[model samples]
Target: MHIELKYGNRKLQGEIPFDAQLLQPCIPPPAENPALQVHRALDRPLAVAPFEQIFSAGERVVIVTSDITRYTGSEIYLPILVERLNACGIADTDISILIALGIHRPQTEAEHRKILGPLFGRIKVFDHACDDPAQLVELGETSAGIPVAVNRRVVETDRVIVTGTVGFHYFAGFGGGRKGLVPGVAARKTCMASHFSVFNKAPQTGKHPQATAGVLDDNPVHHNLLEAARMVRCDLLINTVLSPQKEILGVYAGELEAAHLAACEQVQDLYQPRTERVDLAIISSGGEPKDINLIQAQKALDYGCRAVREGGTIVLLAACRDGFGHEHFYPWFDYQDLAQFEAALRENYQINGQTAHSLLSKARRFRVIMVSEFDAEITARMGMEKARDLQQAIDMAHANLSSMPKTLVIPDGGLVLPHQFVKVKTFADPA
Candidate 1:
C-alpha cells in the first residue's frame, strides 16, 4: 500500500503495510447547540439587573463594536446585541456605535450603513481613530505595565457595551473581553503597547496553549483586559460565538472574564480546525472582511501553525489594505527569508515591535504568502511570495507537488487554523 503526502509544491508517496494508513477521515469536532443556553447565559443579566442599574432613561451609552469587515465577520452579532440593548429600554437614539478600529484603517460610510442597518437611525455611529496620534487620552497603566489610553467618547459615555467574538488568540491568551477596549478604542501608542506588548515575555505555545485553553477568568491577559475596561467604566461586555457557516452558537454577557471564557469554550469547539499532517496549507479570510489588517491577519499564524510541516508553506489569503500593521513589524517579516530577517530583528530589537517580536519567538518555521492587494511586489522583495490569484497559486503548487504530498486544505482561513483542528507532530521523514 502507498500513501501520498504533500509538502508545499512537492508530494511524497510512501509505501506502507496494508495495516498502515495515509488518508484519514476528518470530522470537525461538533459543538453542542449553546444557543439553547443563550437565554441561560443572559438570564442573570436581564432577570437580575434592572434597566436603570446599567443605563438610565436619558443617559448616553455607546455600543462599541467592530464594523463589518473581513475580520471577525461581526455583522450578525452587532444587530443581535443592539436589539438586546434596546429591549433594556436604552432607546436607540441614546446609543452610539464606535467601531474598535484599532490600528486598522477607518470604516467607510457604506460599511457603517451596512453594519448598523435602518432599524436604529437615531443612534450616533462612529469608528475609533488609532492613526490620529493626537486625541489619545491615556488613562493609566495596567498591572502588566502596558499603558491604557481609550477614546474620549468611550470614557465620556455614561456606559459602554463591547461587542466582539471569542476565540483562541496567539497572545493575551484569547480574544473578546478587554480586547475591544485596548486595540479597539485605545489610541495608537496604546494600541501599539497593548498589541505589541506580548513580545516583552515569550508566550507559551506548542500544539496547544495551556494558558489559553480554558476561558478568560483564569487567563492573566483577560484579567489585564478587565482592569483596562474597569478604568474606562465599561458597564457591559457582550461577546458572541459563531459557527462555521456564520450561525450564532451562543452569547455570553455581563462579567468580563467569566463571560469571555465561557464563550471561548464554544468558539474553540467550532472555529478550531482538525488536521494532523499538512505540508502546504491554504487559509482564506473567507473574503468576508472588507480589508485584512495585520492584527486580525495574525490569526493565521496562531491557529494555522500546528498543521504545517517543520519546513513548510503557509499561504494566508487576506486583503491587508493597511500592510504590515506597525512600522516595527515590517523589518520582522521583511527579510530575504524568515530566518535571516527574524535573526536580524531579534538580534537588533531596535527595529521590531513588541507583539510582533513575541510571535517570531514561538514560530517553529514556515513561509507566508500574502495573496491580497497588499502591495504584492513589495512583500515579494521581503521573501513572502505574492499570488495574483488564489487559484493561480494553488495551480502552481499543484504543478510542483511531489509524487505524493499530504496536503491539507482549510476553506475559510479567517475562522480556522491548523492547530485549532489538528494536533501537531514532529516531522522527521524527508521522503
Candidate 2:
C-alpha cells in the first residue's frame, strides 16, 4: 500500500506491505466553534467556581502558558481567556501573559505574536527566564525536598491561571496541569531537582519503572512536580486536548489538578489505541513544529516503539530542521555506553541528557532507521541508522528483517500511543 507521512513541513511517500497495520489516534472532529468551547469550559468548570466568580476587578492576573515548542491552540484560546478577564471588570493593564519557556530559549517577536494572538499588544507578555535569579522567587520546598522556585511575576500575581495542552508525556506522566507551573516557569535548579526524581535513589541507579508514558500514580517525577506546583497558589487551570490536526477537540477548566486530570482522561480516550505487536513499525513525528528538532521528535519514537516486538525495526521519519533541540543535547550522545551514561547522568543530570539516555537506550534495543535531515555519521553517533528518505528507510527495514515481517505504520506518531494487547489465558478450574 502507498502511504505518505509528514516530515517537517513536507510529506514523505513510500510503499509498505498490503497487510501492514496502520496505527492512528481516534480523533473526534474538531469543535465547531473552538472559542465557544473554551467559554463553555470556563462556565462549567470541574471542581471549582467559574472564572468570573474567582477573579475580582482589583486583582492582578497572570496566565501561564506553554512555550513555542509545544503548541496548545494558544492562539484560539488566549483571546477568549483575555476577553473573559475583561468581562470580569479587570482591565487589560492588570493582566499579563507569561510564556512558560522553562529552560527553553526565548521566543522571537514573531513567536510571541503567534502565542498571544489578538491579545499581543493589548496585554503585556513576558518570557520566563529560568536562569535569571532576579526574576525568580523562592517558594520553600516540596515534602520530597525538591526546591521550589518560580517566576516572580507569577508569585506576585493576585490570581494565577495555568494553561496548556494535555498529552502523553514520556516520563512526567502527562503534560499540562502542574507542568505549566513547575518546569514551565520554574528556576533551572528547581527544574533539574524535580526531573531527577525520574531516576531511583542511590544503589538502584536506573530509571524508576513507574516514571513513564501514560502513568501518573506512583510516578515519582509526576509526584515531585505536583508537589512543587502545589507550593505556588494557582487560582484556576485551563487545559485543552488537541486532535492530531492541531485542532482543539476538548477544553478542560477549573481547579488545577482536577481540570488537568479530566483533560488527561480525554487524552487517554483519544490517543491510546490497542494493537498486536509487530516486527516492524514505520512512524512519523507528525510535522513542522513536532519535527522541528531531534529532542522534540524523540516523543514519536518513544510512543511508537511500544507497538514493535523485541529487537524489531523502527523507521522513524523526523525532519529535525532545527537540529538538536538544545546545544547541550548533542554532547550527551558522547557517552556511548549505557551504564557509563547512567552513571554520568546520576552524577550531574540535565533534562536533555535524560532524553539522550532514553533515545540511546531505545536505539540499542531496536534497529532504529531514522529518515531525517541529520547526516548518517551524526545519526550513527546516537546509535541510529540514517536514511535519506522514506523509501530508502522502508527498503532498509526490509533488508534487516529475516522474513516478510508483520508491520505497523503510525502517521501521527507524536500524538498517538499504541499499546499491545496481551491476551491472558484463563484456565478452566474445578467446575
Candidate 3:
C-alpha cells in the first residue's frame, strides 16, 4: 500500500507492505466552530471567575503564551483572548505578551509574527529572557529546594492570563496551564532545578517515577511547577486540546489546575489508541516545525520507542532542517556509553543535555533510523543510521530485522501517547 507521510514542509510518499499494519490514532473531527468554542469557554469557565470579572480598567495584564516549538492554537485563541480582555475594559496597549522560552533560544521576529498572527504588533510582545537576572523576579524556593524565579512581567502584572494548548508532556504530566508559569516564564535556574529532579541513571527501572506522562497526582515536577504558578497567581488559564492535525478539539478555561486537568483528560480521550507492539514503527513528527530540529523531533521518536518491540527498528521521518536544534544536545551524543553521558549531564546539566540523555536512554533498547534533511554524518555520530528517504529507511529496517517484521506507522507521532494504551495482559486474564 502507498502511504504519504509528513516531511518538512511537504509530504513524502512511501510503500508499506500489504501485510504490515498501519497504525494511527483514531482522532475525532476538529471542533466545528473553534471561535464560538473559545467564547463559550470564556463565558463558562471552570473554577474561577469569568474574564470580565477578573480584570478591571487601567490594569496591566501579561498574557503568557507558549513558544513556537509547542503547537498551541495560540494564533486562533490569542486574538479571541485579547478581545475578551478588551471587553473587560483593558485596552490593547495595557496588555502584553511574554513568550515563554524556558532554556530554549529566543524566537525570531518572523516566528513572533507567525505565532501571534493578528496580535503581533498590536500589543507589546516580549520574549522571556530566562538567563537575564534583571528580568526575573524571585518567588522563594519550593519544598523540593528548587529556587523559583519567573519573568517579572508576569509576576508584576495585575492579572496574568495564560493561553496555550494542552497535551501529554513526557515529564511535567501535562502541558498548558501551570507550565506557562513555571518553565514558560521561569528563570533558567528554576527550570534547570525542577527538570533535574526527574533525571535518573536507570530509565528502564522507572527511577524517574514521578516524571511519567499523563500522571498528575504525586508528580513532583508538576507539584513544584504548580507551586510556582500559585506564587505568580495564575488567575486565568485558557488551554486548548488539539487534534492530530493541530486543530482545536476542545477548549478548557478558568482556574489554573482545574481547567488544565479538564483539557488533559480531553487529550487522553482523543490521543490514546490501543495497539500491540510492532517490530518496525515508521513515525513522523507531524511535519514542519515539529520536525524542524532533532531536539523537538525526539519526542515523536520516544513515542515510537514505546510502541515498538525490544530490539526492533524505528524509522523516524523528521525534516530536521535546523540540525540538532540545540547547542548542548549534539555534544552528548558523542559519548557512546550511558554512564559517560549521565555524568556529563549531571555535571553540566543543560536543558538540551536532558533531551540527549533521553535519546540515549531509548537507544539502549531499540535501534533508530533517521529519514531527515540532516546531514548523514551528524546523525551517524548520534548513533542513528541515516537514510536518504523513506524507501531507504524501509530497506534498512528490513535488513536489520532477523525475521518477518510487523509494522506500525504513526503519521502524527507527537500527538498521541502510545505508551498509555499498550495492552498488558496479566496471567489471570482470559485468553
Candidate 4:
C-alpha cells in the first residue's frame, strides 16, 4: 500500500511492501523507581477492594481511555486495567470499550483495532459515538460560563472506568481527571465554555512550578471538569505515568481523588521540566510515537521555548516517528528563516492557520531549530532552522547563543510530560 505521510506543510509518498508486517505494541517493561515506590512498598497499606464498588454483584462494566492514545502504540492499560477489575471479581464479558474521540474524528475500525489490538473479538470493543452533532446532552453549566454535556453512552453505562495517563496538562492541573469527560464525553458547549476563560494563554514562568500550581484552584476550566465527573457518578479512574521509554512506571487505580493524586506524584518524579534560565534549550519528542503527531509534537517546542533566553534558540530533536496527524497543519509549516509564523494568524484563512498561530504564540522570543529524519526542504519552509543531527542542533545553538549563560536539555522532551502537583525542585540547586 502506498501512503502519503506529512509533517508541517510537507508530504512524502512511501510504499509499504505487500508482505510487510504491521507493528505491534510492546511495553518497554519497567522495574521500579524507589522514590516512586509508594504503591508497591505500601501495597499492604492499600484498602481491599470494596465488595459492592460501582457495578454491584451482577452488572456490566465499561472501560474508556483518554483521547490522547495514538495509533503507533500506547501502553493501553488493558492488562493492568482488566486485572484490577477482575481482582475485584468483575468478569471480562461484562466489560467493553470506549475510545473517547473528543472533537477529533471518530476512530476508524482499523484505528480501533490497534487501540483494541487483542481486544478485537474477545471484548465488545466500542468507540464514543456522537456523529449526529445534535445528540450531545447538556448536564449543566459551570461557574466559568462553560456548559457541560456528555456522551450518553458513557453517562448511561452501568459502571464506568476512566483511564488515561497522568501528565501536566496546559489547562487542567493534570491530564487524567475531568479532561477525559469534558472534551472526551462532555458536550462541545461545556468543553468550549470551560476553556472560554483566560487559562490557555496564561503566562508560564520558565522556572517556577509554584506559579502554575497556584492558578489551579481558581481555574474555571478545571472546576468544570470536577463538577461533571461528580454529576455522572464516575465510578473509578485508572491513570498511568510512563518512563522515558514509555513504560508504565506507575499506575494509580481506585477512588477518583486518590487515583489521580497518586498518578500526579509519579508524573512529578520524571517530568518536572524546570530550568532557571538558559542560553539555549534543546528539545524534541525523542522520536516516534510521541513525535508522530503534531498535536503531540508541539509540546517539545512549547516547554523548551519558555526556558530559553531572549534571542536564544530551541533546537527540537524529532524523527517525528509518524509525522503530523492532521493534514491541514502541513501547508502552514513553512518560512524557516523567520523568528515568526505570522501570516497564517493575520491572514484570511485561519483554518490552516491554527497550528502556526499556536506555534508562533508559544515560540515568540526564541528561534526554533528542527533536526529530524524528515524531508529537509519542507521542514525548512516550516520556519525551523534545519539540522542534520542532535550535536549539530546543539552546535548551531552554541554558535549564536546569548546572555542566559547556560543550557538545559531534555533528551526525551515528550516523555518529560509534567503534572502541576509534582512539586518544584529544591535540593538539586545548592546555589
Q: What TM-score against the true fold does each predicted structure earn?
A: 0.73, 0.96, 0.93, 0.71
Q: Which ten residues in a row have the lowest lDDT in candidate 3?
A: 422-431
lDDT of 2 by residue, 194-285 (tens): 99988988743789999998999999999999889988889999999988888889999988899989999999888888788888889999
Q: In model 2, what lDDT does residue 84 have?
A: 85
Candidate 3 ranges with C-alpha deviation above 4 Å:
200-207, 419-431
Order by TM-score, highest first: 2, 3, 1, 4
**Weakest lDDT window of 10 consecutive positions for candidate 1:** 16-25
By lDDT, the best candidate is: 2
So what's the TM-score on candidate 3?
A: 0.93
Better of 1 and 3 by TM-score: 3
lDDT of 1 by residue, 4-68 (tens): 33222233233322122121223343254543444444555522253236766667788888755
Candidates' RMSD to native? 7.2, 4.7, 4.1, 9.6
Please, what are the lDDT tens digits per residue for candidate 4 over residues 1-431? Answer: 33333232343333322211111112345676522432342242223254244445446777777543432123345654565556667788887777776655566676666666666667776666544455566676655455567777666668887767776555455667565666667654455455444223333312123213213556555566676666665676666676655566776667666777767776665565544655555565555555766656776665445555577767676665445655656766554323234432333333224445456555555678876666766665565677776656655666674433355545556545322222233222322
| Ranking of models by lDDT | 2, 3, 1, 4
> Candidate 2, after superposition: displacement of residue 287 in Å?
0.8
lDDT value, candidate 3, whole model: 0.81
- Candidate 4 lowest-lDDT run of ten: 16-25
Higher-scoring candidate on TM-score, 1 or 2? 2
The TM-score measured for candidate 1 stands at 0.73
- Could you tell which candidate, 3 or 4, scores higher by lDDT? 3
- Report model 2's TM-score to 2 decimal places: 0.96
* Clash total of candidate 4: 11
Model 4: residues with Cα > 4 Å off, grouped in runs: 1-52, 67-76, 83-93, 108-114, 129-131, 199-215, 273-276, 321-323, 327-356, 372-383, 388-399, 402-405, 417-431
> Model 4: how far is 154 from its true place, Å?
0.9
Clashes of each: 26, 0, 0, 11
